[model samples]
Target: MHFFFHGQESLSILDWILRAAVIFIFVIFTVKIMGSRAISQLRLLDFVIALMLGNIIAHPLSDHRIGLKGSVISTIVIVVLYLLGIFLSLKWPGLRRIINSKPFPLIKDGEILYKGLKRARISIDDLLAELRKEKVEDVKKVALAIWESSGEISLFLEPQFEAITPSFYQLQTEPFDLPQTVIREGRIDFSVLRRIGKEEEWLIHTLRSSHHTEINNILLATIDRQHNLQVFLYK
Candidate 1:
């Protein structure tokens, strides 16, 4: 234990472990309070807060000279400021403009806007790569493309180039229903079965008669809204 915690200054193995656990729990609590968008959809404000929090929290974990108390207090203050900034951005239009940039047009009316591309700090080659990612072979097929503040390109295909759906033909279709999993990895999910109003005996009987397999043989099984039991067996 001494060897493991050597050169860590005065922090013993147990002390280091306790500090790590506390920091980990504290960070999780703060993240929950800040909301999922802080990590999932990182805008300018979110990015800055995330960067700052990571830097502040990391130093105390490694350096004994930096106390955990100071880091924790600093983190709480930063999180509060971040929340306040988000609230202010929502209430004040002027402040929002400063924090979040408006979507810049990269392509308009099937023509690439070179000026917009320059403003976005992307070259012609980069624009072509993004187009390729959207499965667009020709620039003329794009009706409009906007560079979002989150650094993602939003592409819209010309009406003529858009994929045809059943709605286009005015065709009738069944209502969409998500299949509920009853069995996974050869184990039956009784809670799911209960929720879907199905019995254990019925599932066993169905597997043996319909799928010609036993419960242990199934890798996955789902029941649809229409009482259709689909089973997949292990390979």
Candidate 2:
């Protein structure tokens, strides 16, 4: 990481200036060409390529021996090879399949596939760890677990365990102000009433209008954006 040093004279002034431009372009090109797969997942090949590039580029910048031109050529060739891989992967589906690993199921229908985990090179503990990251404490809760090609675990929980989303009911939502609890557990939250610019008299009048004359009868009451005070009476 000679590119990250300070107060060192490993190379001449011109050498530093020239190599900086090359390094910048090299990094930009590699990252852009590799796509999010290289950044987020970082397959074994990508990791190796990145490490090689760092060493290859830094060596020439650090000493007068390895010469800047050779490093530049090495960087160019590496970038070219990567670009070629992308082009060929696009032209030929079979080659693309070879280059990129497909998602493999680690768990199917709540059963842990030991053989699948073995083929994926993932240990039982590692599989559990990835599950834990998704807040899955037990494999029994998982309906399916796929080891993604991007080196991440994709978890699918049983239908009963999945959270109910708005889409489930086909309900649409509109923006609304946060509801303020005006009463809780048969206690009048005067602070909330005051903040919402209402007094005890107003609360009593509103409750009476709804035939709920007594505040102690309210187990919970909240004021919504529409200034509607929805009250839940104590049983």
TM-score for model 2?
Answer: 0.56
lDDT of 1 by residue, 113-160 (tens): 999987777789988998999999999999999987667789999999
Q: Give Cα-based local distance difference scores for all models.
A: 0.78, 0.74
TM-score of 1: 0.79
Best by lDDT: 1
Q: lDDT by residue for model 2 over 1-235, one digit each (tens)?
A: 4544553545664555456545544664565455324555775346546865898878877887666765666567666666666788789999766656667899998899998887677689988988888988988989999877566778999999899988899999887588999989878888887787889989889998875558888888899867798888877
Off by over 4 Å in 1: 1-41
- What TM-score fits each model? 0.79, 0.56
- How displaced is residue 59 in candidate 2, in Å? 1.1
